[model samples]
Target: MFLFRWPVCCFLLAFHKSAYVWAGYDVSEVTCSQGLSECTVADEMPLGISESDGADVQMVTAKVEVCCKDNAPCTLCLLVDAELSIHVGEDVDKSHSGHDTENDREEATISTASVTLCYKTPPTFPACKRVDFTVCPTELKQKVAKVSLVITNPAGVSFSSIVYIYPSKALHLIEVVAPSLNEVCSQNLQKSIKDCYMPTVNSVINQEMNQVELKFAARHKVCIQYEADGRCQSWESKTIPLHSVTPCLCLQVWDDDKPRRSQSCPFKNMGFLQKNVWQNLTASVRHGRMNNKGQMLLWNLSAPCRLEGEVWPCRWTSGHHCTEIEGFRQQLENTTWEQNSNVQWVKMGVFEDINLQLSPCVMVNLRGGGLHLGPFCSHHIIAAARWRWNLLAVAVLLVIALAALMSCLRHDFVKKWASHSFRGGCAEIGRKGHVVLLSPPDIHDGFSEVCGLGSLLKSQGFSVSVDQWSRMEQCNLGPLPWLHSQLLHVKNLGGRAVLILTRKALGLAHEWSRQQPEALQAGRGDGNVPQSPYSDVFMASLCLLLVDKRQGRTGERFLLVTFDQDVVQPPGSLPEPFQGLHLFQLPSQMKTLLCELAGGGNRKVDGGKSKAGWKWGILDGWKLKTKHTTCSQGAIPTQCK
Candidate 1:
C-alpha cells in the first residue's frame, strides 16, 4: 500500500504543475491540421517504468504553442520536471555495486530536452502531430520532461483568423497666400494655388462700425474689439469718393505770361486736350498778324526770306526779263521789287547809283516823295542807268588820257630799253619790214625768239620794236582801263602790233575769252577782228616750224614747217561768234607753205605776198629748191652747188 500510494502522490503532483502551465496558454477551438495559437508546447511522456535497482521512473512530453505574426519566425518553450524517485537495496549494492549506483544516477538525472525545428516555407504548423518526439527507455527512468522547440519560418506563415495591423498615418500641411489686389499678387502664389477653396485673408482691417438704434432690449451683452488693438493712437476714418479714370495724350503748351520769343513752351500742368487746343489757337493768331511786324515790313524778299529766325517764303528770281531786254548787260545788274498798300511800289538794286534830279518828274516832286523802292530796287535801276553812261564816259576819258600820256612818254622808249638788250640784238634783219612783237611775259623763250627774229629783220633794213605793257599786279582794273590803255598804245604805234605766243599762252587766251562774254562780243571797227581784241597788233603773217637735226637722205640736217590757214578760228569747225580762240594743228599741206616761207625769198616777204628784189628771190628758192630739200634751208643747197 505504501509503494502504490507514493507513486500515486508523485503522479498527482506532476499533474498539478502541468495544469498551471496550461492555464497561462490561450488556444483556439477551430484548430485546422496546421493552425496558430497564442501559446503552444511539445513534450515526451513515459509511464509504468522502473530501474534495475527498484527505482521507479516515468517519461512525459509537453509543448507550448507560441503564436507570432504570419510570415515571421516563432519560438516555443516547454517546462519539464521529474515526477518520481527510484529506490535501491543495500545488499544489492555490496554484492553487485549496480543498485547503489542506479539510485545515485536516478537522483542526478535531468528532466528537460530542447529541440530546434526550422520551417523555411510559408504556412508553418503548430499542431501536436507536427511535433517531433523521441524517447529512450534508460533515459525514461531518469525523468519525464517537456522540451522547448524553436520553430523559425523566415519565409512567413499565413493565417486566416489573425488580426492585421497597419502603420500610423501622418502628413505635413502647406498654406499659400495671395495679395489683396490682383496687381499685387505674388508670382509664386499665382502658379501654386490651383483650387479656390482657400480664402485670401486681408492684412488691413477697418475700425469704423455700422450704427444701429436699440429699441426693446432689457439686458444685452456687447463685445467691441478694436481691429488694430491699442496700436491706433487717434481713431479717425472716412470713405473717399472714387474718381473717373481718364485717358491722356502727351503734349506741351505755351502759357500767356511766357515770352513769345522763348523757344520752350511754359505751360505748367496742362492736360493733353488743353495743350493741343492752345497750340492750334496760338498758331492761328500768330499766322494772321505775322506780316504786320515792323521787322517783317523791312525784310528783303529778294534775299532769302526768314520766319521766326528760320528761312521762309523761299523763292529765287533769275531776272530773265532784265537779261532779255539788256542782252549781255543784264548780268551786270540785279533788281528786286515789292508792292506796298494802295498800289504804291518800291524797288531796290544792290551797289547802284541814283540821279533823282534828272528824272522826267519835276525835281521838286521827286525830292518831296522820298524814293519808294524795294530792298534791291534803287540799286538795280540806278546801277543799270549809271553803269551804261558812266562806263562810256570812263572809257572815253581813259582813252584820251592814255593817248596824251603815251605821247608824252613815247620818245623812242622801245629802242632805248629792249632793242639791244636781247640776244641777236639789232633793229631788224628779216625780209619782213618794220615788225613789232608783243606777248605775255611768262613765255620768255617765245619772246626771245621774237627778239632774235626782229633783230635779224633789222639787219636787213627793217625797223623792229619789242614792247610790253606794264604788269598790273591787281585784278581790280576795270575793262575800260585795259581796253583804253591797250588801244591807245596801238594807235600811237600807227596801229601795228604782232603777238607772239607759245602753247601755254594760247590756252590762257582761250580761258580769258570764255570768262568775259561781253568782251568776246564787243564789236571792233572791222567786223573781221574779234569783238574784244586782246592784242593790239594782229598776227599778219604767222609761221610755225619744227627743225630736225637728224640726218636726211643726203646725211644733212633738215627742216619741217607747218602753217595754219584757219588760225583765226578755234579748233572745231564751229561758226563765227566762236566761244573762244585756240591755236590748233594745221593740215600737212600747210607744212609745204611754211617751208616755202622759211626757205624762199628774193625781195621782202609781207602778208603771204612777195616783193620783186629780195622777196622774189626768197619765194623762188622756197618753191624750186627747198620744196623737196629734206635738209636745213640754212644749209647750202647741195643740188644748187
Candidate 2:
C-alpha cells in the first residue's frame, strides 16, 4: 500500500485507488517520508559467498516510515509481514541468445529465507520504524538483479518497493574486435577473413582498471555498466547515437563535452574505447573472463541497410522506421519486397569477444544493439535454472489458491473455515433456548414443516430461529462460518437443533459434508413429501453440528424428522453428536410432535399422529386454522381436541 495522502481528497496512491478505510473507520490521512539514506547493498557486507546447508548467505536491510490518520480517536494497530524478492536471470532459450548483476538479474526468485519486518504497535500515528526483512546473496554476477521489498498489513493493504541490486564482481569496459559480420558470406567466397583490431582498441581491452573510457565510430550509442558511490548502475548510456545514417554526434568530435557522470548517450549505437573524452565516447567489454566477453559494436544504425543488403535480417526483434516488427524466425532475409527498403534500427551489436569474431551469433542487445552482455564470466546455469524453478513454484501456489477459492464459491462446505469462530458470543447466556430448523430450500415440504414447527413453538412461549430467514443479505458478509455462528447461537440459547432428512438433502450432504454415514440407500421413490433443500441449507446444518461438537456442549437437544412409512428407520446415519442417543424421533408426524415438545402437552402418540394431543397441540391446531399457515390443506389434525 503506497500511500500518498491528499487529506481532503482522500486518495491512496496504489493500483486500487479509492476512499481509504481501515478496520471500520474512515481514513483521514497517510504519509511516508524516506530516511536520509535509502537501504542499498554494499561491497563491505560480504567477503565471499558461503552456502549454509545448500543455501547462500543473505545480507541486506530494508527500512520505511509509515503514518496513519493522526487525528483519529486511538492508535491503529497494524500487524505487518514482509517478503524480499531477488531477481536472478534464466537462460536465454537455447533457440535464442541473452542478458542482471548476480543479484540484479531480470527474472526473480522468492527467497527460501524466512524473513519478516516487524515492530510493536505504534503508540502514535505517523510512526517511523526501521524494519529488516531478509538477506540476499552478494555474489551477483549477472547484469543487475532486481530486489523488491513488500510489506503487508493485517488489514489487507500491501506496500511494495523495488530496487536493483548488483553483484560484488567489479565491471570493466574494454574495446575488442568483433567477429566479421560477413562470416557466412566470406566462408562462401572461401576468403580467409581476419579481424581488424585497432591498436588503440586492443590496448584498452587488456587494461586492468576499475573504469576506462573509449571512442567509437560516429552515429552510435553504448550502454555502460559500473559502480558509483555504492550501487551498480548497469547499461546506462553516456553518449547519444542517431538513425538515418547522419553524423550529428560526429559534429561533437570537437565540442570538448567531456564525459563526467553527465553524458547522455541518447542518439544510440556505440563501440570501441580508451581513457580520454574521445575514449569515454565509446563502449566496453565485460571485465574478467573471455567467453563471457562482448562483441565491441554500436547499435541503431538507420536503413540504407538490409540483410544480404535486402531486408534487415537479425534474430532480435527489430523495427522498420521506429515501428517494431517481429515473429518467430521472421528474419529480414525471409521478408518480401517493400518491407526490406523501409526498416529503421535502434540498438546494434555489443561487447565483443577479444578472441572470437562473427560467431554464429553476434553478441548484440537482441532488443536493439545498444547493450552490454553481462560481465565476461561463464553464464551461471545453476542461477538460471533456479530462477525458472521459482516461477514454477509461484504458479503452483497460485493454482492451489484458485482451487480453494472455487470451492468456497461452489459450496458452503469450504466457507465454514472463514474465521467466523473467532467472533465468539454464539453461546452467550440469558435468552430462552430455541429450536433451530436445518434443511434446504429445495425441500419445500420439509422447510414448510420446519417453519410450522417454529410457529407452534413460539405459541408455547419458547422462541425459535430459522437459518434461512436470518436476512441472508446481512449474513452475506461472512461465509457458512458466519451462518453457522447464527445456528450455534440458537443452540446455545437452550434446545439443540432439528434436522429434516430427505433424499435431496441426503445426496447434497453426501457431497458437501466432511463425514458421512458408511452407506446411503436412496429414498427417491418414496413420496411428494421428500423435497430436497438447497446446498446453503445443508451447509448451515452441517456446520452447526460440527461447531456444537467442537464446543463440547452437553445434552441431545436435537430431534430428527424422517418421513417414511417407517420414518423411525432413517435411510442413512445422522451426523455426529446427533448420531445416537434415544430422543423423540418424529416419524411422519408433524403438529402433534410440536405439541409434545412444547411443555404442557400429552406424551402419547399413535399412527404418527396424536390420538388426542390433550393440550397445546390441539390449541395450536385451532390457532393455525383461524390464523395464517404456510400449508393449510390437511396440515393440522382435525380431531386435535
For model 2, what is the error of residue 505's alpha carbon versus the real structure, in angstroms, after optimal superposition?
Answer: 1.7
Least lDDT summed over 10 consecutive residues: which range in candidate 2? 196-205
Question: Each candidate's root-mean-square deviation in Å?
Answer: 46.7, 40.8
For residues 454-488, write the lDDT of model 2, one tens digit per residue: 66555444445555443221122223554555556
List TM-score per model, in order. 0.18, 0.24
Q: Runs in model 1 with CA error above 4 Å?
A: 1-435, 460-463, 468-495, 519-641
Q: Please give the lDDT score at residue 432 for candidate 1.
A: 29
Model 2: residues >4 Å from true position, as ranges?
1-432, 445-447, 479-482, 511-537, 543-557, 562-578, 581-617, 620-641
Please state the error at residue 170 of candidate 1 in Å.
75
Task: Report lDDT (CA) for all predictions.
Answer: 0.26, 0.31
106-131, model 1: which lDDT tens digit per residue? Answer: 33331222222222112333222122
RMSD after Cα superposition, model 2: 40.8
At residue 99, give the lDDT of candidate 1.
45
Measure candidate 1: CA RMSD. Answer: 46.7
Going through the candidates in the order shown, the clash numbers are 62, 66
